[model samples]
Target: MTITPETLIAAAQSSKAWPFQEAQRLAKRMPKGKPGGVLFETGYGPSGLPHIGTFQEVLRTTLVRRAYEALTGGAPTRLVAFSDDMDGLRKVPDNVPNRDMLAQHLGKPLSRIPDPFEKFESFAAHNNAMLRDFLDRFGFEYEFVSSSECYNGGKFDTALKGVLSNFQAILDIMLPTLGEERRQTYSPVMPVSPTTGAVLQVPIEVVDAEAGLIRFTDEDGAIVEQSALGGMAKCQWKVDWAMRWVALGVDYEMYGKDLTDSGIQSGKIARVLGGHKPEGLIYELFLDGEGEKISKSKGNGLSIEDWLQYGSEESLGYYIFANPRSAKQLHGGVIPKAVDDYWQFRAALPGQELDKQLGNPVWHLLRANESHAGANAPGSGDTLPVPFSLLLNLVGVLGVGATREAVWSYLGNYVTNADPAAHPALDALVDKALAYNRDFVAPTLAKRAPSGGEVGALQALDAALADADPAISAEDLQTIVYEIGKQPEFGFDNLRNWFKALYETLLGSEQGPRMGSFIALYGIAPTRALIAEALAKA
Candidate 1:
């Protein structure tokens, strides 16, 4: 499909990808001809190390920027991953090394606290370096901004003045959300103590809008006068959000759904600060399997390192692309399916309509780099005929930590023409599958005990294999399994259950690639022997 300008424009206009619609809304809401292209912001909190959930937002924001550029005749777009490091260290992250040290720094800004690992200038710097390292590794296009720098560098001096001038109005906007006690003392600006260098949450004794200064009681109850400018003081979160939007002239920004109310308040405060709010995109947060929000404190869901260990960077990108507005489970268990779906999209990309291709998440996943994180690297051979889940199980057939060449040799048993060396992309899957098996599958296999029905089903399958053609293809073998499940005694409701039966008793996993594909690759005789052995104990 040759994607023409007209077709691209129409597709961009109707694109269901959140970024495309966001670009259109931003283009209308924020007129062009500004000093820079459309500016977008992805907020980060440095209280904890970055994770997969945080990484997805940056990648997703980049997609929007790309879409915006295409829609506006290559309009410029800048994605700023702004970290709110100036916010106080409310609590120590459960994962970091130095808990006792961090406990001593509570109420101190993240940028001011000591690095737990003693590597960077501060805890925030360490986290920031970690974020940049992986982002650069993935070749993501973004600029990093620290809230501490913006505050102390006097970069937001003008924004500070504007907020202070409208202090009463912002107070009126915020007071309704606070308790009566907080309503009386809470100010838009959160004063930083010059004496102890902590963010003072105490009552403000004075505010001088003309001078951009606030005097408040410090943590020890001593008077501390601080300038709101030059990073001596930072505005409270919602107010700080509004100030940044105006200071940077952010055209677009996205937030988690939990921030909906705070976002609206930021918009109101933006108006009070004599500026308009950025066009906003609210995404549902990634959740653990238990349907609870994934956070550093909770220690649930896969970390960015964990996800990348068992899957490709593009696989995680595709996971982010799938129904982003809807909350999704981001656990180790979801990795293989994401990898398989990426292949499905790539396999289907060819012969697809231009608009249809545009709508596919695989399309975006492929172009992980500039001009693309294309699912198939240029000249990289096609995806393996087998799915990733299936590949993992087949790789597992070779036992733990089997080298790629060994797995390729195993594939040669059933496929006379099998050559993984020709397919770098598919071969990489073999490596990841080995990692997935060693880490996620091997341990679970120790406790897999088939139920009575599943045992009978396996026994039945073994008996059917006894009479099956020794030279049957994977596709034909798949049909035999389907027929076995359809028999009255098995009474399997669907192929899904039938497949699950095989996975539980055979692979010792909840999901596996199609049995036919495995059968075709494993060869008829070896597969039957494996099944017979598994059913022996039944």
Candidate 2:
């Protein structure tokens, strides 16, 4: 079927996906008959290596951009990935090397500081390169913008002058948000020192809006008058953000929940500069495995490298795409479920109606156009015949020392067409499962002795499996296991406990694959042996 722009736009208008919803919000703010269409911007601070959160912001913004394109019937759009490299480095980051050397450059712009690793022209340059590489590896289409270039090359001259003119207005909007002590020294403009090359945080003594200049006292008690434009000065954090939005005419941007107040204050500053503030989503921050807020300085959160090491790229995107509002514990443990969910969604997409398909996260992640449809979706060739969670459990049962060949041998029995060479995705999943089993599952595995009643149930299960045909279907086998559990003679008041006992005793885990599937995959004789081994423990 031919999918026209009207179908896509109708789907986008009615779709409840967060990206489409954000795009709908953005449509209201779009300027009438703007040249070069709409602009979407995402900010990055190049004080350190870009983390997954940075990638997430760009990915989320790109999602919205794609939805906007669909909403506007393929109107032109540009995504600017802005890096704030001109901001001062207040202190040394705990993650990087050469702490003593970096300490000397404190209060200097990140773009001006020496690279700790000595790879690029400046500290921020090294980090900026890394950020670009990170985004490039993910295939994100964006134009990279350097804050230092904008400030130093006179690109922000008019915006800087606007800030100078509205300095008082910005101060009024900002001062009420600060505490009593902070309000005393607060200034919208931060002049870069000519002698020291540090971004001065001192209060501005005078602002010449006409000449685009500011006067301030340096740290050495020297009173200085400096050009507010052409790299001589930069705005404070909130003001800088607002000035950027105004200068770029950004249509949309998104930030972490922690910065919601800052976004609001910056929006006010943007309006003060005679430019409209961009509409955006305020998403919750990612947390560490311990449920503490992820800090780049502390190196506590999962990096993009870490997530990709254990899961596919699509799985990582799926994890980020699920819920922008809810905080998530990002770690190694979440990868398996993410992989399974990604495939599950992909498999379901072909059957869903147009509206539901548009709402599906996989639709946005995989489909290029409405006509790209689920049957021929990009990356659909990589779908695994088996779920990632089942693969993980297979590795769990086979021990951490399980080999790829051994996994394929069992998989071949369950899925006759399952060939490691043909199923590259399955092959990769097997490797990830083995690695996860080794790192996370192996250490925690401990077989506990079964209760007296559970022993009887195990015996009954083993006997039942021994008498049944070895070629029974997985679903039929499941019925048998369910029936055994439901037997009043087994004394299981709750059916869940019966499965829990099986997992604890047989798999040494609190959770496991379906017993029917496990038995069918492991073979009836091997399962009987496993049951005998569990009974012998008594």
Candidate 3:
């Protein structure tokens, strides 16, 4: 049940989730006495808003790192996120507030786009910073590298020379993949302008160990020249992939299935460049509920920020960790429900077996719960009874403004039936819900206005309640309310329908929590006064 690196590697090999044959070949090339460490790198192209797919990639990489750590008996691993911000923007993303400005920046480096949030200097920095925050929220540790910085730092010089030496090999591979015209458009490392057909050139020079500079001629016999610092490797996309793999010393990386062909070419290019072949894993694509690829350009994607607002951290973790590694589409909305179910399943299974089943990532989540549970603050307890949609529905039906705490109380008391007395863990869960509401939940509960007839019915009920003697016990009050509701003209069904109408008028929703129970808990006096006020306004 305790997943170790060996077990994970075996599982991956059995599942064919990664290139096991290539992994083995690479393993043999590893230096002795130096245990081969896992390195997971996710590439982000900063052309638009970061979406759920980007989160998916990082989450998976974190899971892999955790799994590898467990396997290697706590050996160190590297998780790096590379931002391709140096690349020119190919097209302006839709829904960008400053489309006109962004379009003007098109064909320019992403590092040049003015930051929309005005917090960072450029759009790429803003997006990268957001990505870092998102990863931090998930408890991932990563070293972030920007393409602009890497290139400017001259980190790719050696790799660039290797690429230039293997330029013929690259053309031999790429020429077959691309038509003759496309092949001609490529240089040894860089690409010519597609439209202008001009050979784009870079300045190059050599430097010594003490940082002394020397200008150099092109390895391909071109007349191009530049300073030593400018000698850094800058290549077309595929060659860039090959050089980066060698330069960064990456050992393992996973890509989306859509990029499988490109990954294969990169692998070949790496071999041609005489670098160690990095292990590659391919994960399935994510799809929205409607079965389409989530795309930012099409305005058909969800962002991590949006998901976190409506979902639990555990839910997000489960979405990235529990799913199969094969290519397939995932439903975004089902993620939270799935996480809740996973917790239930873990709770139901025996300890040792459950530990075995959920693996290291889930165990880590449970540990996070244990570490933070006791420190939770008082008055911070409350969570939704069911899903957010359900809570929104209940708020609609109650005809009363409800706080997150109110909804949490209802959910714990009714829907999930989580007994705070029997299950003390439910308190921490409730606290987490309260935190979520405060930090992330959107105010979508107030969507409708009460109608005249609905207000009148509520006013009548309130007047009756106010006239009746106020009872000390909640049970006594509930009995009186039921008695008033049982009248032939104002029966329970009619009263319930009236309440539902009020909800629809106020919230634009038909269904919600039980009416009588909701009123009893929230208090009849406030409920009555709210109704009367609505009637007065009408």
* TM-score per model over all chains: 0.87, 0.94, 0.63
> lDDT tens string, model 3, 57-132?
7766665555454333455667789988767677777656778877676655677668756788998888888778
lDDT of model 3, residue 468 = 53
In order of lDDT, best first, we have 2, 1, 3
- Candidate 1: where is the Cα deviation over 4 Å? 31-33, 97-104, 205-208, 218-226, 371-382, 400-405, 414-420, 443-472, 479-513, 534-538
**Which of the two, 1 or 2, has more TM-score?**
2
lDDT of 2 at 79: 90
Instruction: Give the top-scoring candidate (lDDT).
Output: 2
- The whole-model lDDT of each prediction reads 0.78, 0.85, 0.57
Off-target runs (Cα >4 Å) in candidate 2 are 31-33, 367-383
Query: Who is ahead in lDDT, 2 or 3?
Result: 2
Q: After superposition, how far is residue 59 of candidate 3 from its true place, in Å?
A: 1.0
Best by TM-score: 2
